[model samples]
Target: MSLLADVDFRRYWLARMVSLTGSLVTYVALPVLIYSVTGSSLWTAFVVVAEGVPYLCFGLFAGALADRLDRRRVMVIADLVNAVVLGSIPAAWAFGVLTAPHVLVVAFLTQILFVFFDAANFGALPALVGRARIAAANSAVHGGGTVLEIIVPGLAGVLITLTAPAPLLLVDAVSFAVSALLVRAIATPLQTGVPGPPGGMLRDIREGVVFLSRHSIVRTQTVIGCLQSMTGGAFMGQFVPWLDQTLGIRPTNDARLGIMYGVWGAGGIVAAVLFPRLSRRLGEPRVTLWFLPLSALAGLACGLATNWVVAAAMLGLWAIVYSMVVLTAITLRQRVTPDRLQSRVNTAGRMISFGVGWPVGALLGGLVSEATDPRTAIIWTAAMTGIGVVFAWLSPLRRLAGEPIPDADETPTPAQREPVPAPDRIEA
Candidate 1:
């Protein structure tokens, strides 16, 4: 049965799509606003840091709590909070009080809320669609976002000329408001279980950690996800500066910058359309092994290209393989993880992959860009792709010639179940 026919999944998908459409536009505008004001790659990198730091601090807690509470309520409340906070951006801009520091603060707070929302969201998908349909559902959810990325950013690029990026955030604020409504409208319960008596948040966190650590496939891919995000962070941090410095595309009003980023959306489309086909033929693990090496090469080419058109083209190819690697790895983890552990395991993995990896890469890229040049920094960061390839080859993922993926819905009886690993106590 098609997941589209499922009411809960459809509403969930719509809520997500609406939020992504707005966010993608803001994604382009935020950097443009930061760079136009601060004129420093390091400051731009700070935005990436702000986006990640909250996840580092609250990611575990959010995940633990989400498992215990109503997924729908947590998600809806988070969206409402985000809507209000994001609305403040345009308010500040209207009052002529906007500053880079204000932007950073908002960015930090926004992500903090998202970490909570994200914890619930990570669990919601598998609960709604089941593990068997994950690949197709993911493709649809992300592909719809990609299609918007292609259209909205290019339009946003042109829109930048007509207004300040700060005001554009109002659109994001509205999108969040709409998403909350849609999520609230879903009738089907998004959780399989409410879980029995409280284990306490710390213990709950430990349970998630224990499950992820004991599972070989999940652990290996968590590291791979980090490497991939690092590669992403570095390239993203340097890109604005690279475009501005090399191609004379100013952040204030350059359609070229928007058009360039939109091209990545086109690449994402290629990935979305191609992933299921490739996974069916090549199998999941092998897909990453082969495609990522080419992405590394493409990323390197992005740094070396002299012309804007060539650089954009290289970035598009890089985006395709990069997105594919991420989708494959994420599905593998979700497929292995049981429904109860979904939020905790996924959040921990993302905290490491996105929170830690992205910030570190961006910070390093910023430092490198400050010391040398954006192009040099880009080349250095792009090396993370190659490094990830090495990690994948060394991990157990490489030798699985025909091992079947885990069944997420499978629950062994107590007598049949192997003794699972216990929680490793986290020391303060």
Candidate 2:
């Protein structure tokens, strides 16, 4: 059967699209809700910090859980949990129980569940689609989700005008429920190839870390990823306030940020769709090497912008290149890692890279933006991201263009097993 004809894939894709649209709605509504309650930029930053901190704290544990349990069940549970939590916001508001503290608590809770959902979703993909199709499958998912990014903000804007942001939370809740049902309908068990370590969760976590540290490619990729995320986080955390304060554009009035994000999502979708063929042509590593610098330049451009239009355009460029870089990175990681260790390794990578760096960078950005000019903060962040381009150019990963990926049919040779370490531990 044609890949497009795969029943499970179709069901899962449809579900994700529906849920993503709703998520887009909340992404807009939540901020608006928070801003309406407290008209302070610091509170806005606090909300951002609240959302990011939990992911940093729980990312590794969530990944280990994905490795140990049925990923599908985990995903379903996460979706349902999110649905219920998000669904409560509107109800609370209607009952006059909603407050700034309530919004903060709900935002924190929703993000925590989101991290689990995200980890399980990635962990489950290999089992559902098989390793060979990972790039294409991921591309399709990213592409479909991008399409929604373009539409959802406008939809949310319309909804917000007609009703309070509370009712929009119900839409998010419904989306999650639908996603859960669709995920549950898939009958295929996610094939976890082998268990990593037998002892406690600590041991299992340690083994995963040791494995990643030992792998040169994984180690380098993780380091670069971390740097990229740190810089990206700093920029994103500041961009809203920067635009609002420096450009004299209010967040609600200027939907250009949403447009910029949609453009970025479009870039990612385009990269994902074209990556397989591009990898075949330019070679995966070479493509990354070429694009890495371009992405940095895009960041630099975003920093230097003085006008809203220029800033939005620069952000769009950055979004496009950044999407390509991420798609390539994820594809390479998925291709190289063994099936059994994929979740552990992916989690470890994220834990060290994005999970850790995002909050730190964002917190720093918030502080810096408050202390100095937001544009200055953005420029520094952009400069830092550009510096990573030199590292990429010097690494052996740069020379890996057109190299043939190992055939999946080959069995993985047994490597020395390391003792499991404690949970939430990260190395390299």
Query: Which model scores highest in TM-score?
Result: 1
What do the candidate models score in CA lDDT, each in turn? 0.84, 0.73
For model 1, how does the per-residue alpha-carbon lDDT over 288-328 read when each residue is reduced to its tens digit?
A: 78887987899989998889888888989988988998888
Highest-lDDT candidate: 1
Cα deviation in Å at residue 198, candidate 2?
Answer: 8.3
Stretch of 10 with least lDDT, candidate 1: 412-421
| TM-score between candidate 2 and the true structure | 0.88
After superposing candidate 2 on the true structure, give the runs of residues whose Cα lies further than 4 Å from its correct spot: 192-199, 253-258, 407-428
Q: Please provide the root mean square deviation of candidate 2 (C-alpha atoms, Å).
A: 4.1
Error of 2 at 15 (Å): 2.3
